[model samples]
Target: MSAATRAPRTCSIDAGSVLEQSDGSASGIGGTGHNAAIPSSGIGGTGHENTIPPGGIGGTEHNVAVQSSGIGGTGHDTAIPPGGIGGTGHENSIPPGGIGGTGHEPGVPPGGIGGTGIVAAGTLMNVSGIITAEDYTKKQLQLAKGDQICPGDTIATNQDAKVKIQFADGAILHLLKNTEISLVDYNYSPQQPELNRSLIILAKGDIRSISGKMSKLNPQKYSFKTPSSTIRVIGTDFLVTHLLQQEGALDAGTYTKVISGEVSVQSTTSTIRLRAGESSHVMLNGTQSIITSGGGTCSVH
Candidate 1:
C-alpha cells in the first residue's frame, strides 16, 4: 500500500485576523469568519481574487457587484443622472436644472416667484358717473366699484363724477368732479414698518385724503406732488385743489387745507407748515403764502 497523498494545507481565518495574499499583500479582515468586513481600499484574498459571495463583500448585503468608490456599498447606487440631486433619491441636495438652492421653483422667471411688477396700490370703493383710470401705456379703463388701482395709474373723473379710493395701508381718498390724480409710487408692509412709503400726484383736481398707517408711522415718507408744490403730511386729513390758468375759474396754483393733524407744503423756494384748520397757497412762481380765513373748504362734495 502506498502512502496517502498529502492534501495541500489550508489555513482558516478567524475574527480580526490578517489575510495574506500570495502576492505578499496583506489586509485586516475584521468580524467573525466569512462575515468579515471588506475594507474600502480593496478586498483581501489569495491572488486578490473576489471569492466573497454576492453582496457579501460589504456589510450591506443588498449592495452586490459594487465598486469600492461607488455609493453602492452604502446601499445607494452611484448612477445619479443630471437634475437628480433634488430628486427623490437626494431630497436635501440642490438640483442642477432647478432652483432648489435659491428657494425658487423650476423654470421661474428672472424676477423670482410671483414677481415684483405692477400691483394694486388701492381700490375703488365707490364710483359715480364716468370714472376712468389711464395706465402708463395710455390704455384707459373705466373704473367701477371695487376696481383695483395700481401704481403708475392716472385716475380721472368726468364732469359731475365722483369716486372714493381706499389704499392698501388704510388711507382714504375722495375725488371731486373733473379731478385727476396719479398714483406715482406706494409701498407698504405691516411686518416691515421702515419700508413704508407713498407718493401721489394731484395733477388738476379737488381731493380729500385721510392719513393711513404709512403716514402715521413714517410721516416723512408720504408725499403728494403738484405742479406748484409738494405736500407732506403728519398723520393728517387734508384737502388739495390744483387748477390751471386755462380753467378760467380758479387761480393757477396749488391750494392745501389741513382739516386735522398737520402738513408741510414746500415749493421751489418756500416751505410752510399748516396745522388743523389752517390753509396755504402755493403759486406757480414756487412761492408759498398763508391763506386768511375763508380760503378753501375741505369738503369733497
Candidate 2:
C-alpha cells in the first residue's frame, strides 16, 4: 500500500452515482483495480476489501430504495422496494371508474346507466314501449312519464295505444295507432343548432321519425305539419301518415315515408324531392303524388 496510498489506475465520476452493497463488494483491496463502469444495472465494483451502500430510492415518500448491484449483496431481492419491475406491488390498478378497465362499459362513470336508457348526443332520454301524454292547457289532461311537452302541444294515442315522443336531440317519435300529433313548434338545442326548430302537426295518425341529434345539426330545421303540405327535414328516417283520403274530409292528406333521409314535399304550389326508399302523396285538393314503394300510407289496416 505504498506509492503514497495507491488509488488511481483511472477513476471517473461523471455524475450519476448509485453504489450498492450485497454482502460482498470490494472496491480496492491492497491494489490492482477493475470494477467501475456502472451504467445500467450491476452497480459499480472493484476491490478495497468491498463495501458500498448509499442508495435507497424507493417507496416514494422519499424513504428511497432503488438498488444497483455489484455482488452478493442485494437488498431484499436484488431490486425490491415496491415489488420489482416498475411496481407499486400491484401493476398500476386504478379501475372502478377513474377508468382503467371494467367500469361497466359505455364511456365509464358519468356516461352510462345512471339514467338507464339513452343519453349523450342521441338524447331521447326515456320513454319505454307503450306510452301516453296529453295535458291540454285548457281542459283535457292526462300525460305522465316525466311529462313536459310544451309549445302548443297535442299528442294522442288510443286503440292499441303506442306513443314514444322523446326529444332532447336524440330524437325518436314513434307515435302510431290513432295518433294525433301537433306540436306547432319545438325548439331543441343540442347545444344550439343555431336554435334548432321542429314543427310537427300530423293532425291525424302515424309518425315515425328518428332524426335527432337536433335533426342532424339543422336539417333545414325540420317541419312536417300536414293538413295538406309542408314536410322538410333533410337528415331523416321518416314516415308520416295522415289518411281519410276524403270520405270524411277532416284529414284528406299526408303520406310520406322516406325511411332514411331527405324530404321536401311542399304544396300550396309545388316542391318535391323525397329519396331513400321514397313515397309521397299530398292532396288536400292540391293533389300531387310521387311513388316508389306505393306511398306513405292510407293504411292496410
Candidate 3:
C-alpha cells in the first residue's frame, strides 16, 4: 500500500501589500515566467496544473475576498479610500437582509430625512428679478430701486390699512396702519443663539407679532422697543401698539394694548403686567390700568 502525497498549497496573499520573496529567484521572481508563481494558495501560483479560482483570496464560501487593483498592495474588497465615503456592503444570502444603511421596517413610517435646506419657507425677497423673469411660474414684485428698504429702513403701517411682512424666521409682523413703525435692526442666525437677535422700534404704529421658533428658544434675543415702553415676550403671541395723544384733550395718555398673551410694559416709572385684551396707560405721573369685566380692554390712567 502506498500513500498519496499532495504538494503544499500556497498561503493566501494579502491584498493590502505585494508579496516579497527572500531568495527572489523564481520564474516570475525578477522575470515573467508562468511557472514562477507560488501556487494559487500563495502569492504567485507556481504549478502548471494548478488553477486560480474566481474568488481567490478569502474564497466565496465566506463571501469575502482580496480585491486587487493590480497595484503593489492587496486591498480588501471592503477597503474604503481615505477621506472618501464608503458604500454600504450588503448581505445577499439572507432574506430581507442588508448591511449598514438606514433600513425601513415594515408598516412603519421612516423618520424624515434632512434636505439641502436652501431657504426656509416664507423667506421674503429671495427671488431675484432675473430668476423671476426666466421662470414663468416664479412670481416677481418690482420694488423700486429708490424705494428699496435697506437693513435699517423704517416705516409706520397705516392704521386704516395694515400690512404684514413675513420674515425668514417664520415670524409674522402685522403692521397697524397710520401707526409709526421703524425697523431698528433685524438679523437672524440659526446657528448661533446669541447673535440671532431681532429688534423693532415702534415709534407709533401698532404691531401684533407671533414669535417664531427661534425667538421661543431664546426669549431674551427678541425685543419690541415701543415709544413709551419695551415689550418682552417670554413665549407667546401678542399685540403691541403706540397711540399718540391729541395735543389738547381732556386727558392724553400713552396706551399699551395687549391683544393676546402677557406682555411686560416698562414705563418711565414702573413695570406693569397686562393680560390678553388688557390695556395699561402710562401718564406723566406714572402707570395705571382700570380693571374691567372679563375679556374687556383696560383703560389706564
Candidate 4:
C-alpha cells in the first residue's frame, strides 16, 4: 500500500464539556418571630406610667430595635447565625450525576469492564489497506486504520500480514500474520488511578506487546488471557503466540518469550515466572512448563 493511500489512525476522546452550575439554589431561612423585648411587669416604680411599644411586646418582622424602660431589660437580636447557608460553609457530597463519586469506590466496577466510564484504547494505524478488525461489543467487523478501537474489539489479520496499533496509553502492538486477539478490558483513567485496567486475550497466532503507562501503574492487573491460561506482565515488552492444533496431548499451544522486564504465565496446574532471555509454554492440559535451554530464541512471525 502506498503512503498516500494509507491514512493515519485517529483515536480521539472528547470529554463532554463539564457544564457546572455555579448558581445552585439555596433556600432562604428567616428567623422565627415573637420575642418579648421588655418584661410585662412593674417593680417599685416612681409613679411611672406604662407605655406600650409597637406590636405590644411582639417583635416586628425583618428587624426591630427595642430599648429597656429604665433598669434592666435585655434587647433581642434577629440575625441569621454565622456559618449558615446564607453565609459560606457547605461541602456538597452528591453532585448532579447521582452516580456521585470518583467511581473508584469498591464494588464500583471500573469502567474497563464496561461499567460506565468509557474511553477509546487506540486504533490500527498505517494499514496495508486490507486489515480488518471485529468489534465484539458493537458487533461490527468493518474496521481499518483511523477507526477507534474499544475494549471489546477482536482484530484479525491474514497470512503475510502485519498491523500496528497505538493505544491511548501510549502502548504499541506490532501484530504478525494469522493473528487473532481481543482487547478485553481497557480503561485508561490517567487522572483517576483506581479506575484503570488493561486486558488482552490471545486466541491464536503471534503478536508483540509493548507496555504502556496503564500497565506501569498496576502491572499485576494488566493481563493476557490465552487458550489454556493467563499471562501477567510487569510493564515489559514481550512476544506471545497461541497455536491452534487438533486435540492432542502434550502439545504446546501457547508460548511466551520475554524481551525485556518480566512476565508470569499461569495455568490451572502451575505458574512459571520468566525474565528477559527466558521462555515458557503451556500444553493442551493447561500445564505450564519452562522450556529447556536449547533452541532458545525469540521467533514469532
In the order shown, the candidates' Cα RMSDs to the true structure are 29.0, 28.9, 26.4, 22.2
Model 2 C-alpha lDDT per residue in residues 224-274, reported as the tens digit of each score: 777778888877887988875654643477778787867777777566777
Error of 1 at 207 (Å): 0.3
Q: If the candidates were sorted by their lDDT against the true structure, best first, what order would they fall in? A: 1, 4, 2, 3
What is the lDDT for 190 in model 4?
A: 69
Better of 1 and 3 by lDDT: 1
For candidate 1, the per-residue lDDT at 274 reads 82
- Error (Å) of candidate 1 at residue 199 is 0.7
- The whole-model lDDT of each prediction reads 0.55, 0.45, 0.37, 0.51
Candidate 3 Cα outliers beyond 4 Å, as residue runs: 1-150, 158-160, 247-253, 284-301
Q: Judge candidate 2 against the unseen true structure and give its global Cα lDDT, from 0 to 1.
A: 0.45
Regions of model 4 farther than 4 Å from truth: 1-118, 246-252, 292-301
Candidate 4, RMSD to the unseen true structure? 22.2
Q: State which candidate has the highest lDDT.
A: 1
Expressed as tens digits, the lDDT of each residue in 1-301 for candidate 3 is 1111332111111011122334321211111212224322221111111121111112111112321111111112222210001212223211110001111223211110000001122222221121100011122222211122222334443334555556656777666556555553344445434434456677764667777765766667577876566666655577665656655542344565565666666666777666776666655445545333234433332
List pairs with backbone clashes in candidate 4. Answer: none
Tens-digit lDDT string for candidate 1 (184-271): 6565656545546688999998999998898988788789999999998989899999977645555679999899888888888777
Query: What's the CA error at residue 283 for candidate 4, in Å?
Result: 0.7
Candidates ranked by TM-score: 1, 4, 3, 2
